[model samples]
Target: MEWLNKDVTIYDLINDHYRLSLWGLRCINIEKTWGLCDEKKLSEVIVGLIDSGVEAEHEDLNGNVIEGYNFIHNSRDTCDEFGHGTNVAGVIAAKKNNGVGIAGVADGVKIVPLKVVNKNGKAHIMDVVRAIYWAIENNVHIINLSMGVEVISSDEMNLVRLAHINALKVAISKAIENSIIIISSAGNNGEDSIDFPASLNSVIAVGSVGVHKVNDTFILEKSEFNNSGKKDIIYAPGEDIYTTFINNTYSHTKGTSIAAGFVTGIVAYMKLIDPKLNQEKAKELIFKSAHIISNHKEEIPFINADNIMISMWREKVNK
Candidate 1:
């Protein structure tokens, strides 16, 4: 509560951003609803925030951040102008129980902000490609991409406008070759398909789930804009999740973008438990720990971050 910026009045700090973020914490079991992970260990993972930059000086995130790049403006200032990147990073690694704001899903991991999306919320495909490579070169353990563009094939790499999409294919493939875990948002179109990168085989496509109360039965329904398919898709709480915002503030936003951040946190925490964990093994643990939201009506498998640690313990005891 001390570091909360003076600009963010004490009342606003508790009412706006921090208080309502409990959905994400509960979904990930940061509160230990299942009586797990008592120690709250610090993780060694370095997560890449590849979006609209971040407010590196924010009270909740300043300490855990590393020097980042701004591919959009080609500068050293990675401060967020659009607020989305800070929000995503806050979901992934905002310091826990900091008194001023809500905790992130995986605390203790470093965040490397890569400014790909611009203040206008428009990002060139080439900018995104360069940011991914920059993050890879910096040796970040995981790259969380919450944005995507239409697919472009190798044959169409010279459309001037569509060229970057093709180049991104190679960039993404190289990142995977180096064994970096890439987690992306399932396209927010309310269709059965995701966009490129997310639809590709190499990345974990994340979809959003909304906590809905209908007719006295609680239902974890898909976000209205969530895109779904069998392509490595995972669902997490995303609808109107509260997160850090620019100007030392907070707000609630919706879509698969928020869901992707939670999944990235899960990956980071998994790596912390087992330093040798790779992209393939992490995916396995996540899928194995997922729970079916509604088997009788909806078959969406929602992630239970609390269960992964429990599963690991059960196996250890059985041995």
Candidate 2:
């Protein structure tokens, strides 16, 4: 019924009977945010998703997305062709309770869809840098980067790669200095190292945690493809995540990219609670409010969205 503006002729809607597949939200304790904080301030938060692009006219994301730029084509047409950005955007701010598709982690948040990657889902590092600068100029509160370059620990970096890396670092620093919260995927290499940008300073790197429920109990496992290290990285539900797709469709995906989306949404919600919540403070709060998932090598932090909101709210009230 509400598919008038969607690009596709036939749009998929989440039926009432089968609307409970959003286990990713449940894994992060997202429902505990009910009656939690200042709901009106949510609209003040804007997340700049630097990826392929977004289907702004999708049935579930129509009103939630705002004007953005496409670096590949050097045009204003930010419609998604690679489909990664749509999925990430849906995870962060898909319309909630409109009785259509699945609910996003955070509600009332607008997304600025910055298309950095091309139609093949490949992007030059300079394009990503440009996107970050654009987000700073637009005054976005949060930036979600679901893409990164893989690096081998033993490999030698050439001058060009090093220059690109430096450019990205400078751009990210500028964003952080402007009080923007940057969340990035911790790569999907399944190695002991995190990828660039995600591994860069002041960026909140997110890894994937596979969630399993058995006999009314929730179990968390580190995803095999998720990059982990001794660095301060947080985990989120990424395996078999259900989210909005291209052409106004809904489907399941899995990766550290999806996990980073969850962190982005939670960080946006935290920003709504405390406008002064910067990158350092957000990382501190996320680490503090997280549920620990440990193994023999390390203790990973699985974010708890409810705890983050409650903590920020309490800080505001006590002040």
Candidate 3:
């Protein structure tokens, strides 16, 4: 919610926007990362970007996007309407160094776009559940969820209602059982809290942070809209981050949504380094290689993809 330039500032990072986007990638250390996995294995490593939709035909994303389903309209195509999914997708894997827009954290990986939300940016738990099952069936290595309940409630509800929420949780568990990493936004409400699926135990909840304009500093300070709480796991630069948008343009947006995308990208990078990486090991490496923010009462760490890649690459050599 730290929407400094809500209207104008929150535009796409296209038309040579990579120059402005270098900071976030540099912070994560993905600015210069170009790791490699086996071509055959890389082709099989699909990363699911679940949200409203994706502009799959966009110049930067078209090549890597594989067959994706639209649970919203029950269609085979997953073109974006609300623009969130496409933005998130670009952040995670927007065809790197294409002499166009910015590069995603895991530019080389294939993306599986799952359109769960409609044009209004709304998605039901049922569709979300279905999307997870779809991603699992398609053998996705990672599932990035940038949408979820605004808040979770403890009040007792009807059996049918509770069952729906439970069903989504169950799908998350099944994904974990399959060794798939599930990453979600911690919400952008700037509270000591987490949204529904993000609050779930198996999901890696990512919070948002703002980068100092001049000093280039880092901290786990919650964005005005970024939800926080004991359930928080990782923090990433989310405010006014530049990324791909609809119509092959670029824009800047804020929220834990983008933060979740950053972590998703990091997780994908970890997998690229080791195709057999499990959820726990991927999380461990991300947490261990992050920028530990001290003096912040809570011990949540911020992701530093650069350090992570260096350590991982070194380990790869020793192995």
lDDT for each candidate structure: 0.76, 0.83, 0.77
Question: What C-alpha lDDT, on a 0 to 100 scale, does residue 91 get in candidate 2?
Answer: 90
Against the hidden reference, what TM-scores do the models get?
0.86, 0.90, 0.86
Please identify which of the two predictions, 1 or 2, would achieve the higher lDDT against the true structure: 2
Least well predicted 10-residue stretch by lDDT in candidate 1: 1-10
Identify the runs in model 2 with alpha carbons over 4 angstroms from their true place.
1-18, 152-155, 212-218, 294-298
Better structure of 1 and 3 per lDDT: 3
Residue 212, model 1: lDDT of 69
Q: How close to the true structure is residue 57 of candidate 3, measured as C-alpha lDDT?
A: 85
Candidate number with greatest TM-score: 2
Question: How displaced is residue 38 in candidate 3, in Å?
Answer: 7.5
Q: What's the lDDT of the predicted structure labeled candidate 2? A: 0.83
- Model 2, span 194-268: residue lDDT tens: 888788758899999876554555467788898877678899989988889999898899999999999998888
Candidate 3 Cα lDDT to native: 0.77
